[model samples]
Target: MNHGSQPEPPLDTPFGDWLRWALVRNGYDPEERGVQRRFADASGIPVATVSRLLRDKGQPDVGTCYALGVTLGIPVMPLLVRAGHLPPEALEKEPQPTERPRTPTTEEEALTALGVIDETDRAAVKSVINALTAKHRQEGTS
Candidate 1:
């Protein structure tokens, strides 16, 4: 992995161990250079929480796992599934249809066609569209 990139953790690896592995993959040594503290700062996670997470001390909440996934540049679902926040089925790739697909037309439909997999990410896309639409309205551009 590159200096800023994280490796995908093995499926059998414990979540806490994977968290530490992510630090190493990103070129940060949690023990030597206060990587957890830096991660806390970068991720807005508390130091104590990061410490406990590293030590596998407690079950992390969904939001915490989501934040960690965002910070680590990894898909949040796998972590969420591992943490029991989401079901394994949620991560399964849907089968492609054998027939023709419906095409989207309107802006909203087109946005929906982007195929955002996560509800949070989908909401974020909608929020951005709403904000941009409002700005366009203010500027008399749309």
Candidate 2:
């Protein structure tokens, strides 16, 4: 029996669209990423069958992923990553932590001297500390 052209029912409807959107964003031109056609021709599975499979959802379980990979000339692991079932390895890079500004001894000294003049000096010291920290952050970012 011919499986109609309608998309397969999925556990999460948005997931399909989200996957499709990611595929497109990742430079898989719809024209070139003809996964169904590619799978069908390579696997000897009918295009209609592949099309029906694409329509179904629920994270493209491992077996389904393997079937498509076998047909599409893609590795199954990467395909799962594309669908967000697997985290993309490219995203695993540790972002270099920015170094913050060193607390300025000069500012600390100035604040200490000011504290001697004003009995209520805690606020001024805190303000200086905050300023140094902010400067350090800004310098590291640049």
Candidate 3:
């Protein structure tokens, strides 16, 4: 519970170790002054909870892991697995394929994909595309 400027002890558990490494990798120094409070504020976690996690005193719940992952710009599955909430096998599960938006195949499609609804804007875009295509063709023939 010492919140002084002294460097905190190294985390001992696997999750805690990983969290510390993640923090450092994301440009946070756990041992720096007010780092716990900063991390708690950034992750929307309580200061006590963050401190306890840093000390390897308790496991983080799913919400906590999600918040930490968002704040750390890292994936949440690893956090959950490391916190012992999910089995290591969970990491091996194949991710479901997300449906990707279809690519625009024409100038009109590109303008629509960009949500350009104004007729004037569409005309301008077409003009630019035409100019680029003409330039490319001229260059190819050179």
Which digits, one per residue and each the tens of the lDDT, describe model 2 over residues 52-130? 5445434555665676567445566666665557666634642435655345477456566555446457666677778
Q: Across residues 1-142, which tens digit of lDDT does each residue of candidate 1 receive?
A: 3433655666556778888888777666777767788889998999899999889887579889888888888777788877767777877753347555788877567667887757788778879989999999999999
Clashing pairs in 3: none
Candidate 1 least-lDDT 10 residues: 1-10
Off by over 4 Å in 3: 1-13, 98-142
Error of 2 at 34 (Å): 14
> What value does the lDDT take at residue 65 in candidate 1?
85
TM-score of candidate 3 on Cα atoms, chains taken together: 0.58
Displacement of residue 47 (Cα, Å) in model 3 is 0.8
Structure candidate 1, residue pairs in collision: none
TM-score of each: 0.58, 0.29, 0.58
Per-residue lDDT of model 3, residues 55-126, tens digit only: 888899999999998998878887787787887788788365565667899877888999998999999988
**Candidate 1: segments with Cα more than 4 A from true spot:** 1-7, 93-142
